[model samples]
Target: MASFQIIIIGTGIAGLATAISLSQKTQHQILILESSSVLTEAGAGIQCSAAASRVLSSWALREEFEAVATCPDFTEIRRYEDDELIGLIPANVNDYSTRLRGFPHWLVHRVDYQKILADAATTRGVKIDFGQKVVAIDVDNVEVTLASGRSLRADLIIGADGIHSRTRRSIPALKDVVPRRTENYCYRALIPREEMLKNPVTATLIDNQSQQAWAGQFKHIISYPIAKGKFYNLVMTVPDHGDAPLGQYNEPGDVSEMRQVFKDFNETVQAVLDTIDSCAKWVLADLPPLPTWSSPNGRVILVGDACHAMAPHAASGAATSLEDAEVLGLCIATCNGIADLPRAAKDYEHLRRPRCERIQEISRENATTFALPDGPMQEARDQIWRAQKAMLEKQLQEDTPLAIPAEDMAQQFPHPALVQWLVGHDIIEEARTHLATRKEIHNIL
Candidate 1:
């Protein structure tokens, strides 16, 4: 009998979710490797849309997630120059249990979410090894060599490393694939909740429990509350003027430099900026859609950002990875032994590629729209948002049949649709159906 041993690279959301989901269906010894001496995630916020929530909830993480995440009631968009309200997209979770089958939209800190996933995975018997950098991989043989020259073998190897994944290069068939800089650098900051609440200017902003985005010439900023309102997460994306291959992904940034970038922004935005003491900076990079994410033997495969590194505009970067983890985990569950893994891996690629690629394209488009300069095109985009906002308010008034005042209309606008294509997808059920058909075909053969 083949050994049901699995080795996963990285300890991020993708790796942990994969281990947890796979352990649910079968008893397998899973090992996760991390290169860092200490496990830490960047200080930033991540939005978990309804679709991702469904996947996590299925894993029995709903209660834990709700404890640390804030379910925003609405997300507002404004012009950076004058703070003109252009759109107010209400959360689809407004009716909680009715829409998306009770799935929620969550805003959480990256570090907190990582800990939750890691804790869940460990409770299921998944072993995690820190300070172990994988230096080489034999895809066909399902073997990995660490920097220390120690060799380990498994029935399967999953590459869950991020955009600059070394595991991605280990596939012998891929030689030209590399992460390309998008010329966009992201600056991140975390504001202490107590200090923010103490200031009258910042207190009202966070009191409403909403996610806000401000768009400007060639840049944008998104801010929201995480850790049950313990901290405010802020991310600002601007065009990078520095040379490529900075030799590192993250660097220290000064608060004064960041403030100057948005010096012309509205008073509210400026007020929030003054509170930031320091920021972390990183250039956003993504890889082109690879022809395949599996090795020739199919015993080794790539998941998450390792294969579909996308711009963060669509807010689907981590969510898509969760979808991948859920589906790939289900597909692997169909494997009766190591011999069946190749077919399962092939099926995973077949089902995942199209969906992930579409999201990748959408992310780029969203980024382009969000970063448009002050021009006719930007004006047109703003006009569309205004029209949608008006229509949504009208619908809200009609549905409620109440004489709402104009001042209250801002809070009464009907919820707008999120990326409809991604919001309600049932990836788990789809994977199960795919596996059922595969079994049928095998029986007939």
Candidate 2:
């Protein structure tokens, strides 16, 4: 009999959530190793979409989430240079999420959201050892060597360490692993609502209640409300068309550097530059599609950002990560705990790989859909999108800002049922099919 239990080697959102969900399947001791002292977020805002909301509701944290998260009024897409409105995604003061997923899509500050998740896990008896960085590990023995000189072992090890995952390297099942930067450089900052309100340029770009996106050649700038409309989150992305050196995201830039990156953006967008106190420039990174998400020996597994780091265009990263958690959670529950850890790990890899790969493809293709290069084709595409949107808006309410409110949504859409399945039941069937004959799907892609 193995004295080793479930050892999770990171305390990120994906790691913490894994511990919480797995804790339910048995009384097996769970240990979390987090490198950072204070568990906080690296970014400002995140759009937790329907796919994510469904899983969240299952944890029965809706009321608690509602208390901290903001349901924005819109995600109106537009042209970057001219600021021409192209598509309006309604996000108003309604239960639109409930329409899509019997719940809602929430845009919350990263730290605030992480706190919600962290608190829930700790309250449920997950033992999180913070301030402990993982230095190395011996996968065969299922032992983890911590930076603090403590050694821990487990029957199962989870590599939720993130994109630069240490455990991902040890898995013979997924070698030739390299995280490529997607040529998207993002500059992000926060603004006080009062300051944003005073500027005509900024005001035109966004109100306190809605989200705004202006698409350009190979890029876009988007802003939205957070912290109960007290502050706004803004992100501007541009084209490099070439990859950056590994770890360039580690550097922070001042406001001057940010302006230079988006120099050709509209004047309204420039208003953000003046009011911006500071900013961070990030070179987004992600892994190529893998044939399997499991170790050949079956003691280690990958999840969340490590497995599927899609482009942020569709706002699907967080959503997909939660989906990863749900699939792995159900797998453990069915297997009867860490006692069946190997089987559960294999099941998790099979269920998630294809779904995650599809999402990755769609996300990569999606970024360019709105921001085509400047030329004749760009103008024509913009005009067609606007014409189509105008045709659709005829049936909607005008007071509904430029973005689609959940109420304005087509009642027959499939978003709601998906949501229902996400929150109300186990998606064991879908997971099984995804990983079904996983070898064929891996080669096909």
Candidate 3:
């Protein structure tokens, strides 16, 4: 293997994770560019399923992550109007060894998780330059021009910039790839655990350390505890009626308006909303599946939200980004020199694109299923949930595994098989297998 210069744009989860993973797998000189002068404390809570958690564990971040993250015991789904229990999924149970791939499902604050990755990457000899916004990308020359008119050349460039990626726009081949607004907006707020505990209705949530979701007509709410359970994170997604401006992705939300939208929700949800002093409204948008994730020469490539930004309905945005970082690193490690960079980039895209595209589709489907109005379809969905709940309860009481028909399982929200496939996937092993097969083919040829 030969050493090369690698530049990763942005310092979000994808950028930082790529830096760390590449540092561990390859001998390349890695640099991360951040547009912000300082690491801003933005974003709300994020879920880290076993798929991403396994990658973090490989990077030796488990202890630090566990210290700041909350492992919810289970997840509960309920009706919006009367708080009728619809379904229950065990998230972090001892007996259910296969749950979450035997790794704890982490509910963590985004800021804390990013800091951990940043620190780990720095410790591994990766350098991050702040306030170095990428203004343009020269795919042919394998270089980037910063906003300050500084040109930096590298052997390869990874565009982890984000949804409004300048790097993606710089590539002529990706001109057709654009983000489309989903007409869905989310109001995010955090309530203090102490405040919640003061109210008995909300105290149960804090005590259980469980994730809760309320499904309603054209809207839904999901809440979980983060920051070591000291703060509770709330996300309310509803139809977007020009709440935020076209260009603005995130802005201050009106508390009164947020409360009114979910005012008809059950008492517990209302209590949670009432505890919020302020909230931020964010517009939901997603990109169509791109024809390619790399330039013609493959010196430049996209990762994370830069190429595959999806609706947050599935709560797998960050996890998928982490998977991208891991898979990219593993693929790049197979390259012997600069000439092999193109093949490595192609392999990264081949392994990642289908999975990401499928997840994107699932996220969009969830947005509809989670907010069904009172209708026959809504009733049918609720009936599936009720059946699933009964089956889960029966399994607990009988202490035995009951064979569930694949079709029956498919009907449940969050689809058990889908959850397992999402969280239990070993990206590392798959990358290794892919590389091994490619090597054998090359030898035979």
Q: After superposition, how far is residue 189 of candidate 3 from its true place, in Å?
A: 0.3
Candidate 3 stretches greater than 4 Å from native: 41-43, 95-100, 401-412, 440-445
Off by over 4 Å in 2: 1-4, 92-94, 200-206, 241-244, 248-250, 337-339, 398-445
Q: Whose lDDT is greatest here?
A: 3
The lDDT values for all models are 0.80, 0.69, 0.84
Name the TM-score of candidate 2: 0.85
Q: Among all windows of ten consecutive residues in candidate 3, which has the lowest summed lDDT? A: 403-412
lDDT of 2: 0.69
lDDT by residue for model 2 (1-445), tens: 3233777878777887777666654555788888888795866878776566667777777777788787876577766676667775554345454543455778788888788888888888788888889887777877889887988878778888888888787776665688877867677787877887788877654454668888777778878877777678887777755644565653576688678777777776777778888887777767899777767656787887877766676676777777777778666555533446666677777667766776676566656765688898777766766665675466354434333333311221113232233232334446655545444223110
Would you estimate the TM-scores of all the predictions? 0.92, 0.85, 0.95
Q: Considering summed lDDT, which 10 consecutive residues are worst modelled in model 1? A: 404-413
lDDT of 1 at 264: 77
Which of 1 and 2 is the better model by TM-score?
1
Off by over 4 Å in 1: 1-3, 96-101, 244-247, 398-418, 440-445
State which candidate has the highest TM-score.
3
Tens digits of per-residue lDDT for model 1, 1-445: 3448899999988888898888776678999999987667887889998778989999999999988888887678999988888986655424432253447788988898899999999999999999999989887678999999999999889999878777788887665688777768878899988768767888877765788889888889989888888888888988888653543655888789889998978988898888888888878877798988988787888999999999887788889888889888887777767777778888899889988887777666666777789989989888888897787677665655322222211121122333444655677777777777764333210
